[model samples]
Target: MIVKTYQINGMHCMGCVNKVQKAFISHNHISEADVNLKNASVKLQMTNKLQLDELMDVLKNIGDYEMIENESEIHHNKFQLSTYKPLLLVIGFILFVSILSSYKTSFQLMNWMTNFMGGFFIAFSFFKFLDLNGFSNSFATYDIIAKKWKGYGKIYPFIELGLGVAYLLTIHSAITNTICILILTASTIGVIQAVLSKKQIQCACLGTVFNLPMSTVTIIENFTMILMAISSLIFDFFKQIIT
Candidate 1:
């Protein structure tokens, strides 16, 4: 077995690092791999020697980010992430339109539609989270927890539905506050996990619908939700307090 040393570039954070590592192992012949963000390097132990062209191509496929074979050896645009860029843009725009619709119309319909959209986002992420491979990915811990915890996954969609319904059914300040807190708490945990894992990997959050960069978007999107919910909650709370 030849132990080949390769470096992955353009990895800005832990998520970038993990995604590059996955790119390497996606090739079946690779026996093992170890990556370090500190050095921005990847070490691969291959089953046997292979064609250099094949090796380079496979590594490039795993990541649209840059990968360098050696120092001063730069590969430019080995893959195109531009395709996914449009998808993320669409997700953002749709979110904007959805929020805007609520502002322009009756508050009740706004609340109902927004709740459904938000719930659908969470439910969609929940499904992609399940598609994870536990052994290869760090974030796959959710899957393990869901499996052992039993019913967590099945129950979560229902919880999200409940949150949506609560918002739709009543103007309870407490309920809105609860929803905001729940979203914030969950997003905070997601950011913490992504940071701690120290690998660049697809967030798999939006699934195939929106190929947004996993970076801050996931956390940010949830943060926005939490903030909106919190704002609604605060307003409701004050209204209740005044009444």
Candidate 2:
């Protein structure tokens, strides 16, 4: 068995690894593949000779992946930080702004959570709008609803934008919070399944612009919004009870 190593680009998570491995292993010439997400490379044990073009064709069928044979440089740790910097920066900015926005109101917990959810939806939706088609394709790779109905991926950003506006305007509090719970709960189920199944795929949470990998962070992002909505609803219910 001849072992060949190829440097891969655009692999941000284990989901990407799973997809790449599947592509290689499905081919008759490729006996086994060891996909290293950290290193962004794949080691393939080949039972027969295969050309670079052939391997490239297999990846092309999968998604947006670039491969280079004979390039074995590992910068997995650095790659993670660099890859997720955009997402982290956006999250930090959203949190900071959300907190700042509530300062004038004396930092009421519910108000702060409202602003945070608004900021989260608006900011995340902005990214998705950048490349709607790309985001839809990537999102469909894992999102159960999107996978079944491609139109859901296309319209999801608009839904988020609407929710953001609703929260920011503080309109229809009960309805808005309820929608948040339902929408995010469905999304969280998909994220949890993708992570548990170890599918190597890109995360569409930040859209196709950032090469964010499918991971636990994506799960937390979904659950955070869900929790915020649930907490706000609970607080309102108790306030109503006291009054």
Candidate 3:
């Protein structure tokens, strides 16, 4: 048997490891396959030498997994802005739309913030809704709440959707902002831990569609929402006192 080692990109948790392992072993040529989540590498013992393309083809239906040459390539892939293009594009689009919606006579900070948060949640939740099972599996890997109760992962998309609708409607601002603060704060804590621990995992921010690696970017995304929620809450409080 021939043995080969390859670095894999887009693997974040044991669920990914299991999926990849199954994909390889499903192939007749690959006799044994071992996927290492910690290192994001895979070892295969095959009866015949398998080309990288051929091996990659096996994972086409599974998820956004890619085979790389080495650890350095993994690091290189992680650091490149192109690697995060999808996420950046999504945020940029949301910002544009939010500004457009809020700017009529002049720039309204509160309106813009509300529109931005609404767009952010709706867009992100849409992605999660695309593949709830996939998103849940990925989310449970890093989310503190999802880690404890797998059901939370499944329900998270609905919560985001609800928050988005609430924000868009501009109803019960105090309660909505409070919930947002609590949820995102909890999320940020988990993200901070993951980033500090230097775990090479997938970010479920865009669900399973975009293969985003967990990084400071993920922290910023969560933190920004938390900040917005806090700002909204404070604004509402002062507005209440004034009126």
The most accurate candidate by lDDT is 3
- Least accurate stretch of 10 residues (summed lDDT) in model 1? 132-141
Estimate the lDDT of model 1: 0.54
Residue pairs clashing, model 3? none
Q: List, residue by residue over 1-243, the lDDT tens digit for candidate 1.
A: 335566766667888777767766777657677888888777776543334566668756555655556543224213345635654564666566556656766667436445544544555445444532321132233233443554454454445546655654545547655865764465457555754563333444443233233455556656666666666766666877999
Clashing pairs in 1: 14-199, 15-200, 16-200, 17-200, 18-199, 18-200, 19-200, 19-201
Give the TM-score of each candidate: 0.48, 0.70, 0.74
Q: Write one digit per residue (lDDT tens) for candidate 2, span 1-243.
A: 345688889898888899999999999768799999988888987643455778899999778999886633233412355667888899999999999887777768878888888888999999999988778877777777888999999999999999999999999998999998987888888889988876546778888776676788888878878888988899889989999
Model 2 lDDT-worst window of ten: 71-80
Residue by residue across 52-79, what tens digits does model 3's lDDT show? 7888899999999889756554457556
- Of 2 and 3, the candidate ahead on TM-score is 3
Query: What lDDT does each candidate get?
Result: 0.54, 0.82, 0.85
Candidate 3's clash total is: 0
What's the distance in Å from true for residue 101, model 3?
A: 1.1
